[model samples]
Target: MSRPPSNTHDLTFYNGHWYVPSPPIVAVLMMPLAYLVGGKNISTADFSMFFSASNAVLVFLILNKLVDRQWIKLPRKSILWLVLLFAFGTPHLWVGISGRFWFVSQILTVTFLALSVFASFKSWSPWIVGFFIGLSVSARPNGLMSWPFVFAIAMQVMREDGQTIDLKKMFAWSFKSAIPILIAVLSLLWYNHARFDNYFDFGYVTIDGDPVVVQNAKTHGLFSTYYIPYNLRVMFLYLPEIHPDGPWPFLPSGAGMNIFLTTPALIYLVRRYEGRWWILGAWAAVFFNFALLIMYHNTGKDQFGYRYILDALTPLTVLLAVSLGKKIPWHFILFVVLSIIINLYGANWFMNG
Candidate 1:
């Protein structure tokens, strides 16, 4: 299934886009392969293809664990669901084809999320858990937001099994996990220092090479103020402006609306599935909503709705999968089908546009 051309301008950060510098070394570990294959100046399509492949592999690994654990079972006719979910969740159709770094981060974030959940169920060494969590943080700064949930879940696991909390054990785990994360962070800092002379610079600050202060100014103010309110309105109310060339021709634009318009089966799944799994869902939802609030407060274009928070999609999908196991009401199934149609139409419009 080929997607329609994007209307947004291509973003070429490597070509002297000062503030919009190259991705961190940690994030672009695959660039060497890309460069070798394409010899620099790789097409956006190439990048998307690489990202999609990487993401697919990671998604499969994570999903396989769930299937193995019997927490969820893949259905014979579930291929459509998988295709649709992956298509919609991918950044290629939403953020323009050039945003491969974001897609990679999303994949890494989801992988971390799955590992975190896996860790909660088993009695793993603190060091191992820390390593997974730290890797997640290294993938994207936003990974930090999920730490509270991870910690809580780990604590729950300990308490549920009647293990006394040992501060010393916890500290040891923290130190062990911190080592890998520290190395990654240090590497990132070193790259930033070498590139921009600032250890904290993470390329976002360069947004087109303007000074951080200037970019900050452009990202916030009266003009961008309505973005937050607009995002909130669309996210909860399911109203978006129609994109002339968007994924859905009949509905309002923005990807965030999909959350509300998702299949009723999924919604029911969320409502019915309660327990340790619910904790994961809740954590993802809370962090996503928090991220939306932050994005709303800040100024930036909201092209694909709440896609900036797409990193949470995997956990949400897992929750939905778990929920689908319960008896689904017929009316709810109807609602879900309708929502799927709407989402598909919207996705088509987006790709075509």
Candidate 2:
């Protein structure tokens, strides 16, 4: 139970105001709804669920457009299946249900991720793409990693259209595009400065609060070689604890499963695949986020799966949608079905536990 400006997940007190390390876009967006629904009575869980489900619909619409634009082609059934899988067959269901401040960042970042892709494909406007990607980074700082991928895709699109690589024009366009993003990044820095007097501080100080995280942050400095193995376990090898005593097979607290185990469709990533601009961008985005997660001190405990990957799910799910448009070997489909069952089971167990 956090006070007025404080958050349940992470909050800092300074000069009679509560400060949260996470970026402000989610709170900014929620202000309208909070006002409408009576801020004191509104449930974050409900808002998170609504936003999470809405993201599913947004993905479906984006995918449908992709299909129409011939970026990827699939029968209507397969298209719908992929959308459903993305919506329900992931840790997002559990995270959405949790509805803490941290989960709000996750939900918002993923939505921004999808919006960036959607804008890129729809208009290829450098300004719009940069703006959305900037918003994504504002939602989750790691989203800044997407910059290279976004520009790379823009280059690829230009080439595909037989447009010459005009360095001056491109620079001009990118510079103009970056204006809004720069303003946003600066605003976040200002927010941090206003709270902690350090432009870069996200309030991860042992002196402030949250002992465990503060200690971990102090020890590892947030990212370090020490975190790799433990993170690997969280990302690829962890499993749920089995508790036989509960009415149902309730999952133990702090348990987690690897994406491969919980969402097996990622196995399809091993197979040979065609590479396009968006696909390459998607892969780049995934790799960047994974690399960041690998070095971070926190492994996102008390989760069904690595919920940190929710932000990356936009690109990852896009990759899955592209896969579906292809031949979709039997094994891939089988893995997807298996993933659905595992996630469903995991969600139910988590909720009941």
Candidate 3:
């Protein structure tokens, strides 16, 4: 829907001129805020925060339920701390205050994923989870692989009752959950076809003026094993550059910062056991989505922290909660505090830059 200048990046070269990627769902969501501020795009800086706040609430609710059900017990105070951690101790902090287009969509995906998880946790209708996944993929196609979450929740009943798998019930649940997802995938294919006359193309190859990405797309193709080293470095090994004299001493490289540095608390993920089927399913879901993102071209530019990591943040949170178990240890709390400080620095850098 956006028709910017020809040189502007992220536009698909269509039949003639440039066209926007994906419809303006974020713009429509921000309509009320725009009207409140006399209809200025500038007012959208708070739009991301709206979803961020919703996510905080969702996290709190999820944690509280886990405690109540004794799935992963924690004190009330610990719940509040984890909620704060998700809001400020992670990349969501940098994403929350940004008015930029990509940030808005990323934060919305965070919220949508959280809502989908919340629905599953509450044992609500499986369709709700599928519907939210449909919404999530609309925001970011990486979410298309979130289908495992549907299966995870669908099997919750059997797991809770300690019953053996029933193929017929499983098939029924799979059928119900697949309806919205099929709609989303078909709709996305149709949108791509309408734009570029190619059902499978999302126009990443036509991105304007990015020679490195284009070269990589040509040499290694759009998604290839060649990108794994670079993506792995950025996702885990890359660190901030030391500028002894610059006002900001440790600046993240343009590709993005490592997740462990920004949120070291995530390292607790290894502590997440796979004793439960749904928990294993959660890991599968996140890794399934992450595998596609890690292999894709472009490591996200002009971002405060690793934005792609946010895709699996919700499932990771579930794992984190499980890892915490009955008590919140001092070191985990310290890791979370340090994470908040680091992300706060990131938010400052992005807002000022």
Candidate 4:
């Protein structure tokens, strides 16, 4: 009993055909690179490194844009630190270098998330925003939650400029805004239908010989009340035990540690945000992912610090920057430094392991 054409990351094999459970945009983008490098012999680790490094640069650019627009005023040093921490102080570094299909897909989604956030601040056209968001969804289904946040920001900007949304204008704008998103969605549907003969099947639940997946499908489904506890542990409370006999003094791998352990700066997000409208929009986006992931079957398995939460990093970073109190809290700085060190160790461990 075997499945043919054996790269099992996102693809599902059924009825003598190959199908990708996730949307195909990422694969489409990689096709050219794969072709150029002689597909059979290319190294995914190399592409993963490229995508990760590129995302770091993109975040640097986005921070620069924010400072230039005076969206959030801070010293240049602070901006640099924020960028560095985001790049190295989270799972992005590890996942980017891991070079697996799952990690690469996340890298793609984060790129679009960065673009969409930048577009929102720059007051770019809804078409541009929709285009990026559509790409985000095509990269990862969880990315669909970003649309409302982007649209809300657009609406807030209009209100500040003394423009209101009336019935006619709202309907016209909604239709215009939906065009690109509709195209992406329809394209994905067509792709799925062609592969699996069903428009709605992503094949996640039907993964071959996965006991957890089978149980999840038959019992509580992909998302349900049963998943919250495991998610809570991985997202908030799970800690690696001291294993002096192991490779490093802690558990080398399996499940994941809490977010606070990996990136302490994100703890800032836990506090109440009494700030601008965009801050709320960002929080809303994070909450949407929080709720969704809380019920998901996997905790972004075999990773460091809950890789699933990577989708929320854009909003989380926004919240982190906005919530920084004046005077550059030294304790916070120490916490962030510790976070960077921890993640660096974890990333190295993950890459080698």
Candidate 5:
């Protein structure tokens, strides 16, 4: 164990021990499977199937919840269409296909976020929803921002079912929900202290990697506004490259693509959506995640179509479903199809290009 490994990219050496700079939740989840499969025999690609399967099933459950709770809502055709769209039309598909360490973590992060959202809508125990929230944040610290949306949905759904959220019950539920999140936070703090002798430093600036990235992290420090312009450019403005020599008309750059360009169906979000109080919390969650992502030291490396958007995808999809209601409009179908086609290329690029 004391012998050093050859590859040190993103690995840190401190006090005669080595550590990797990543959240360990998803890796920990995979350890049992790895052991059973004789670890070395398992291909990395197989690990990502966990996310691809989870995303498809979670989309079905989230959409079906509307009908399960009350009204005999959308037809089978519409539900199937949405499942296809969600599985193909967003970063979810490509990220799972990639299965790089960062991308795999995103897979689990998005999965837990969807589970947390579903628990809120299903009006499961507030404790369960909070547990999922803890799981998400443990996967990626940014996921902590989504707890507001989950809590609001839980309270509002209970009220809709005519269960009173009296002050006593509210306090009790809040306390219960907060427990898991508190535990997750404390665990992370302990991990950081063990690794770096600090409660706050997750060691991004100290991580070893590509020279350009190292310089940027060292120059501006992590989470500086100085990094916002490049991040915004990649996340929103960068488009398909018009290549002069390549046979393909447009080349997919490693730089991320515009969010709306990738998923045009989201344009409908500009229209008047239903006036649900809890949706404010969902939108708040999206904005909060976006603000932190854009200010981070790096946009992303070797990505297609703004992978960071996965952080807010659950709340955004919840808002979009409410906005569209039961009817599948012609324009909505057109946009979703376009979004799927775009992501088809993204998935191809991620796997083979």
Candidate 6:
């Protein structure tokens, strides 16, 4: 017998969530195949499957490019191990289908970062650079916050091989890269205006005139005044919690485990790769997350663990993969296994919860 249509708002389904719809726009763009198989029932969890899978593929490609560049190298076995690790290690890979925007945004954001890295290595046309940057911003408005980091990287590139920046060349490059950003901003404005009659309505921002409430809404609960200190204490002490009615399984509690466990390799990379372009990218990722946390805390509505920060996980993963290839022995292989185990446990916890 055909089952009755389930409640769309059930945690298992997509219809129950509350957020601006911009993320769905990007999710649909990235995974048109989801629409074909699940049609309109493509719940947030369903989209997460697509997003996480896509991210896995992109991470491999990005790593391949990095390997070829000699930034890091690994044996075939190690490469296999690393790939497996990333594919299974992160919790998002396993339980990300809960209809969260973080998985999709993270994939898009990381892809943009990879493209930017590629562009920095080659002499790409300004239009191309601009387009990618614009796409990055469109994927998430917070992406615009990374512009300074991008500029810093570009400046570093100009100083390539100890050479000085050529003013004319720099101007031309900067102008070209600005094109996509301008387009993205204008497009975002147009989208907002169409939906909310303001170029910057951002949905949640319109809930209340109070900046605190609006800002907290954006983080989904990680940085609210009450939750921030509480969560931070948990994270610092290595304690994980589970909330029955939380957005996702084991939230706030298991979520901290995710950040704490994965961040060590990232920290190691930053210190080891200091002054390198990759290090700058890592710093950008950190800056982006910290800024979001601060914004969320100021807003005072702590709910989720600021899960939105997951958007930066891609750059972090890439940085770790590359950096591990350098310092730890067979690091890729070992890390991958660890990541898979962690993700598996997290997923299992979510399913049971």
Among all windows of 10 consecutive residues in model 3, the one with the lowest summed lDDT is 1-10
Residue 245, candidate 2: alpha-carbon lDDT: 83
Question: What lDDT does each candidate get?
Answer: 0.52, 0.74, 0.77, 0.76, 0.80, 0.55
Off by over 4 Å in 1: 1-27, 41-101, 115-132, 152-168, 201-206, 209-230, 241-248, 251-258, 262-266, 269-285, 288-302, 322-325, 328-340
Q: What is the lDDT of residue 40 in candidate 5?
A: 74
Q: Which of 1 and 4 is the better model by lDDT?
A: 4
| lDDT of candidate 4 over 4-86, digit per residue (tens) | 76565445677776565777776788889788877776677787788788777777777676566556666556866777778
What is the Cα-based TM-score of model 5? 0.92
Ranking by TM-score: 5, 3, 4, 2, 6, 1
Best by lDDT: 5
lDDT of 6 by residue, 1-353 (tens): 22334432211112233334453346547467665765555566655566566666766765665566565665433454455655565544543555545445655665565566456555456577667667777776666655544555566655754767777866877787888889778878887666666676655533422455545556654245555664454334543555667755444453344354633233434435647765575567667666565445332122122244445655566566656654446554455566566566566655554
Clashes of each: 18, 0, 0, 0, 0, 15
Root-mean-square deviation (CA) per prediction: 6.9, 3.1, 2.6, 2.6, 2.2, 6.8
Give the TM-score comparing model 1 with the true structure, all chains together: 0.65
lDDT digits (tens) for residues 1-353 of candidate 1: 22322431322232233332433533365567676875456565455555555554554554555555555656534423543454443332344343455555555565665576567556576566666666666666555555555565566656656877688755665576567667766766786677666787554533432243345535663124446665566555665565568544455443355455433334444454456633664466566545645454332233344454455654555565566553434564465556556555554555554
Candidate 5: regions farther than 4 A off: 69-76, 166-168
Name the top TM-score candidate: 5
Candidates sorted on lDDT, descending: 5, 3, 4, 2, 6, 1
Q: Once model 4 is optimally superposed onto the true structure by TM-score, how far is the C-alpha of residue 196 displaced, in angstroms?
A: 1.7
Question: How does candidate 5 score on lDDT?
Answer: 0.80
Kindly list the per-residue Cα lDDT of model 2 for residues 223-293, writing each as its tens digit.
Answer: 88888888887788776666688665646335356787778787656645577766777788888888998
- What are the per-residue Cα lDDT tens digits for candidate 5 across 1-353? 46777887777776677787777897788788788987777655667767777877886887787556533256645777677777788888888877677788888888898898888888788789889988888889888889888777777787888988888877887898889888988998888998889888777777777677778888988788988888988887888888778755567667678888988887777767555646777888999999999888876766778888889887777667667766778888899999999999778877777
Question: In model 4, which range of ten residues has the least summed lDDT?
Answer: 1-10
TM-score each candidate. Answer: 0.65, 0.87, 0.91, 0.90, 0.92, 0.69
